[model samples]
Every structure is written in C-alpha cells, then in structure tokens.
Target: MWLFLSALVLLAAARSLDWQAWLADKSRQHLCFGAAIALVPLWMLQAGIRDGLEVHFLGLTTLALMLGWRLSQLMALLSLLLVTWFGIEPWHEFGANLLLGGILPISASYFVFLLSYSYLYRHLFVYIFVAGFFNAALTMAVKTLAFAGYVTWSGQYPWQVVVDDYLSILPLLLFPEALLNGMAITLLVVFRPQWVRTFYDRDYLINK
Candidate 1:
C-alpha cells in the first residue's frame, strides 16, 4: 500500500541522513531540528486547506520547544504520514484525523515530557505519566475547537459529521500514541540523553 511505501521511503531517508555524523555536531542537529519544527504547522495548514485558515497550535510548538526541534520535527512528520497512509478513513479524512488526533496529542505529550523532565522534575516515570495526560487532554481540546470553529465559519458540516469524525478516529489512536512517545522519551533519557538536546546533563553523563 501507499502507506507502506511511504514508510519505506522515510526509513531509507533517515538511514541515509548520516545521523552518526549529524549526532556529533550540535550545530547541524540544531539546524535540522529547527527546520523540522517549522514544517509541522505548514503541514497542518495543508491538511486543513478545505476548512478555513484556523491554526491548530496545540502542543506541537511545545514539542518543538521541548524536543530540540529536530526530533520533534521528525516524529511529527512520521506520525502524520503514517496515520494518513494506514488509517481506516479515506485519504482526506485520514490527513485531517492525523493532524487533529495523532499528531496533536503525541506532540503535546512530547512537549510535556520535555518541559517536565528538563525543568520541573527529572524523575522519568512521573514525567512520562504527566506527558501522557497532557497529550490526551490537548488533543481533545484542539479537536473540539477545530470542529466548532469550522462549523461556525463554513456552515457546511453537520453536527453528526463532527461527532462521527471524532468517534471514528480519535479513540483509535490515543493510547498507542501515548505509549509510543512515553517509551521513546524514556529510552532516549536512559541511553542517549545527550543526543536529545532538550534534556540537560550537567556532569557529562555520557562519558560516565
């Protein structure tokens, strides 16, 4: 399927990115991360083109802020593309669902992880739990606002349509996404914390 092909292409691209070298150079990684974060809202804008020009600035910005731009960008694109290609809905609906449901919540959770682990608390488990909760809440809130705003502005969709969209999609994606982000952040902290610039280590944990 197209989704599988996209995944293959993404994996290939990632493999070819010279990550070993990129990882060694902080400046290059920072630039790549910045560019990646900048692309998410643009991708969302493209998905929302049929609707009005309302920006769904959920925790994606937070994720970018917390995850050092590069990883956030990479994850956002990966989640968006994956959901679109493999989801049950039609392509258009899939893209919308991805932006609203999968991308937003996961990104929000990533943001929460970044903020809490870096600034507030360094305890890994507590950070993961809080991130999951915030991701779920923000994903729901953004979807509600987006649906209501679309209906108010365009007057084209029925209430049933809105309900159906959420009912059909959001429930399916929430938990798996939270788990993925949680596990990913936890592993990064444990094994490769320096690669994740959003996390700060004072005493050269990598060498020790």
Candidate 2:
C-alpha cells in the first residue's frame, strides 16, 4: 500500500509540474529554493509520541498561498528530501509522509483559497482572515483527522490510542497554525506583496 501510494504521488507530482513556466522565471526558482530551505528547519521542530506520527507547525498553507499548489509541492519535495537525508525521517516512508503531511494539507489550503477568492467579499482582512488564518486552522484540522484515520487503518495504531495520543492535541495545534500563517501573510501583504502569488491589491485593496 505504501509503495503504491508513493508511486501514485510521484506520478501526480510529475504531471503537476509546470516546467516551462519554472524555467522561464529565475526568480521563482530562487523563491522555491529559499522557501524549501526555510521549511526544512520548520518541519524538524516536530513532536510526537510515536516515531512516524509527529506533529509540526506545517507552513504548507502559507507555501500554497504564496507559490500556488504546484510549486508548493515541488518545494515540499525538496524539503522532504533534505529531511530524509538528515535521517530525521526515514526514506522508506517518504512518499506516504509527503502525500499525507505535505501534499494533502497544501492542496486543502489552496482549495480554501479558491473558495474564498470566488465567494467571499474581496476585502484585505477577508483575504488575511479567510485565506491565511482560517485556511491554515481548517487545513490542519483536516490533516489531523486524516492522519489519525490513516494510522488506524494501517494497523500501526488502534483508534483509541490514536485519538488519545494524536487527535487529542489538535485543539492546541490550531491556533498556532492560524497565527503563524496569518501573521506571515499579513507581513507579506504589507511589505512584499509580490511574494504572495494569490494576493492581489486590486482584488483586496482597490474597491474597499
């Protein structure tokens, strides 16, 4: 199952790559490298009861909001490779970890941004609150539940133990996730708005 899922994730990532676009813009290439470099340390600062089931401040929501999901995945892959190389994470579980902890949350974050962009009021605070804060909190919640379910289904841990040890920490996780990502987006919007790909002054700041 792990091998199969890993293969599928690799295939999806390959198909998702915008090679021409990435090659055309050198700055974005640097951005990807810089973001990945930052993420490696962030992911290292994780805590958990068991070996494979660690919880960390996932900066994936901000990554998705900044670079779009495609580049976010690429950046995550780069970070995960470094993590694995450093022996913090086993290479054998790389695909499963990336699929669950990286791509899933990143995609969820992007989906929330899309919903906000389409239906919500186009205000700066709305963008910061919904796409930045709310999205990070909600995505982490979903990822928490999904990870619990995956562990239980894989027979690595029973449901009760998973709930008690892993799921129980979720509430504590949400606020920090929200605050970190929210503050990040806020600072970027104020100082380096161009760094955030999903943010547009015309959309959020022009009319209001």
Q: Which candidate is the best by TM-score?
A: 2
What does candidate 2's lDDT look like per residue over 53-87, in tens digits?
Answer: 78988888889998987778778888989998998
Local accuracy of candidate 1 as per-residue lDDT tens digits, 1-208: 3345434544554665667877898875675555445545444543233343232333443344345434554566654554345442347544444444444444455555556666754544554456444454455455555655545445666666655543345554456444544555566567765545555564323343
Q: Estimate each model's TM-score.
A: 0.45, 0.93
lDDT (Cα atoms) of all candidates against the true structure: 0.49, 0.88
Candidate achieving the largest lDDT = 2
- Show where candidate 1 strays beyond 4 Å: 1-27, 30-66, 69-121, 132-137, 140-148, 202-208
Pairs that collide, model 2: none
Q: Which ten residues in a row have the lowest lDDT in candidate 1?
A: 46-55
